[model samples]
Target: MTDAADAEVRDGRDLYVEHCASCHGAELQGQPEWRSPDKGGLYLAPPHDESGHTWQHDDSMLTDYITRGGQAVVDDMNVSFTSGMPDFGMVLTDSEITAILDYIKSTWPDRIRATQAQRSQDAWVD
Candidate 1:
């Protein structure tokens, strides 16, 4: 890859650490009991690694979640629940958000990446 590409990947990692690591985990491991809701009925942050369902989503949906936050997205779907995720659209540019997501995608294995990429493509078609 070119130097500019390398820098962008580095920037993505840095952005993820700065904005997402606290809740998601420094290594993208996510919080404990992530599948379960807390007493207050809020779900914990799920892992971004291969073990989690991050790969199951398309890029556009993921982008919307990050840009608008889980609450707003779920609200749009008419889901009855609160989200712990915060909106980053005001704080981060669209490119920066993409960087963070790119960083997350970088961690997955080749098959996982391919699957997610296909999902993204399918989403565009749908």
Candidate 2:
């Protein structure tokens, strides 16, 4: 298997650390009490780790969330929940967003990754 040091993996790690680590945790642990809203009523960034629901979403949903911001994406899906994630569409290229997502997925356990991949495929089929 290719090592984590591969160019895309390295770039994904670097980009995630620079852009997403602060809110999401350097290790993708997310913030404390992430399920609950903050003092400002904003949901804290959720973990991208196996413990979180990030794996439950497909790639398109994840990409849309990163690119369109949580609110807009949620709005598009008519979801009732509020999303605190900011849209990175204007600031980052599609490739960059994909890189970050690749980094996030790289951390998941094999089972979780497989499940999530299935979800992504199912979403497209539906």
Model number with the top TM-score: 1
Per-residue alpha-carbon lDDT of candidate 1 for residues 1-126, written as tens digits (9 for 90 to 100): 688877887999999999999999999999999898999999999999999999999999999999999999999999987789999999999999888888889889999999999999999999
Tens digit per residue, CA lDDT, model 2, 32-89: 9999877777788999999999999999999998998999988888877777899999
Off by over 4 Å in 1: none
Cα shift from native, residue 37, model 1 (Å) = 0.3
Q: Which portions of model 2 miss their true places by more than 4 Å?
A: 3-5
Candidate 2 TM-score over all chains jointly? 0.92
Provide the lDDT at 99 for model 2: 83
